[model samples]
Target: MNPTEWRTYLVTQESRSAGRETAAVVEAALSGGVDAVQLREKGRPARERYELGRRLRDLTADAGVPLIVNDRIDLAAAVDADGVHLGQSDLPAEIARGRLGDEAIVGVSASTVPEARAAAEAGADYLGVGAVYRTGTKDVPDETNGVGPERVAAIADAVDLPVVGIGGIDAGNAGAVTAAGAAGVAVVSAVTAAADPRAAAAELREVVGDGR
Candidate 1:
């Protein structure tokens, strides 16, 4: 439940998995020793996402890793996920906490010190901050995209919650994010689209370890 301890966090996206199933990608990541997983299959039907979440929940639970659902508290509850991660445009963290209860691990995306500080005030357990490098994995605001490590350092210095640097991060640059003060790194294609996801995750984990 401690995000600061999640050195290697994987955000799932089947489209980026080189035609593999989302479950398959996650299975590889788990074996690669990912510290946590987030189910982030945006644009899919609710039933489809729920069924996938069910399978993911089982995998992560067995692996003893936390499984977080993206932007859907009900889906998280339906699949009995470990928590929910919300974007700025999604539900407020406080309302999400109210529905999920105080024990749930609620996180919100942020790219600046103000956003990070606001999430802290809203009782978020952690902050997903970045585009520390350019990203195409998800659409991001131009103003915040590629904010870089210095922005990460500012947010970490400004907020009290753990910060998970995401966006465009890979084994090559993950260290910069952590060196800048992120507690962990959250990545999609770094593991999902790799020819060998297990090895990709392991390499990124190794880099993050060195940085930490």
Candidate 2:
């Protein structure tokens, strides 16, 4: 993937069955037009996470979409994932760069103007911004966080890197998300929790225009 695709879909596993359901949901998302998939399963046992990473990497590879592991450089390397996506609380972009090298794609989450600029300067390939609408994740959320499209636009305007919008985005309101300047939208529960994962992914693709 070029990493500049207009609609990047992220799949983060949040519950007990996340590991088991991740592959199928990710495959459906790819079939529906997701450019990149990030395997973000936090707080799980290391052994479980490693196996999950392997499954995601294989599925993404077969689908021809890049798979990035969230917050774990070691697991990324272990599973031969395409890259790593890091949050502000995770490893620094420059250090991640050093660890992963220039060939891999590295993304950093940024909420404020300075943070976005710093991540760019530090060599991040892209930026993931939000909690745009209050997410089920993030305990002590970013201060500037909110799902307002305007706020997401503000962050996008502040940096040159490709931007991905996260936090509560879905079919009912994804239009405002893209209109706000997001290159893509990352979701967890929307597709995974749906009765039909493929249908959910297809609907989201319609909302975001299949990454254009």
Candidate 3:
């Protein structure tokens, strides 16, 4: 799988330890085979998120992994990140394409077959399909239900693009996610919550057969 096409781990600032920043966890995750990173900071003002995005961009670029901004196209464009991952309420994929142009990788979150199909048709580079498990990050999940193995498999069958199973995925179940047809697993807490973020990332990637 392309680096950006697998094991898509998202690093949320809030998921970090009391004093740790998201950047620290992201750097560690990238070093341990995290193919892509998304900066998903809610409640933070645009400037702060943009600033944070810049640091994350620099960090991921150094590791040769794409950094994606979550839900903030303007901040993403400003930081010149590799891409943006948007929710359904955010700008539609078509409009985002018009704004970011062809080179930028654009992903959309979709919970069902019909949504996934429409997102692909709209030129999304991939689908972020989940809440494969519960997550503290999202206040209101679009489906309010987890994307279990059956749902994952069905969505994978419905969509042609790479699918990253997100929300609450951890090393313990990452293999199951991949087996369910997800191109990768996107996690938030597992790595960041660990005392040794790098080791946590290493262990997690190992579970997904990506230890290197």
Top-scoring candidate (lDDT): 1
Each model's TM-score? 0.99, 0.91, 0.92
Whole-model lDDT values for every prediction: 0.93, 0.78, 0.79
Top candidate by TM-score: 1
lDDT of 2 at 77: 86
Worst 10 residues of 3 by lDDT: 1-10
Positional deviation of 135 in candidate 1, in angstroms? 0.6
Model 1 regions more than 4 Å off: none
lDDT of 3 at 66: 83
Candidate 1 lDDT by residue in tens digits, 48-112: 99999999999999999999999999999999998999999999999989999988999999987
Tell me the deviation in Å of residue 72 in model 2.
0.7
Quality of model 1 by C-alpha lDDT: 0.93
Sorting all predicted structures by TM-score, with the top scorer first, yields: 1, 3, 2
Q: Considering lDDT, which of the candidate structures 1 and 3 is the better prediction for this target?
A: 1
- lDDT of candidate 3 over 103-180, digit per residue (tens): 888999988898899999999998888878877666755564576867878999987788888777888888888888
lDDT of 2 at 4: 64
lDDT of 2 at 135: 70
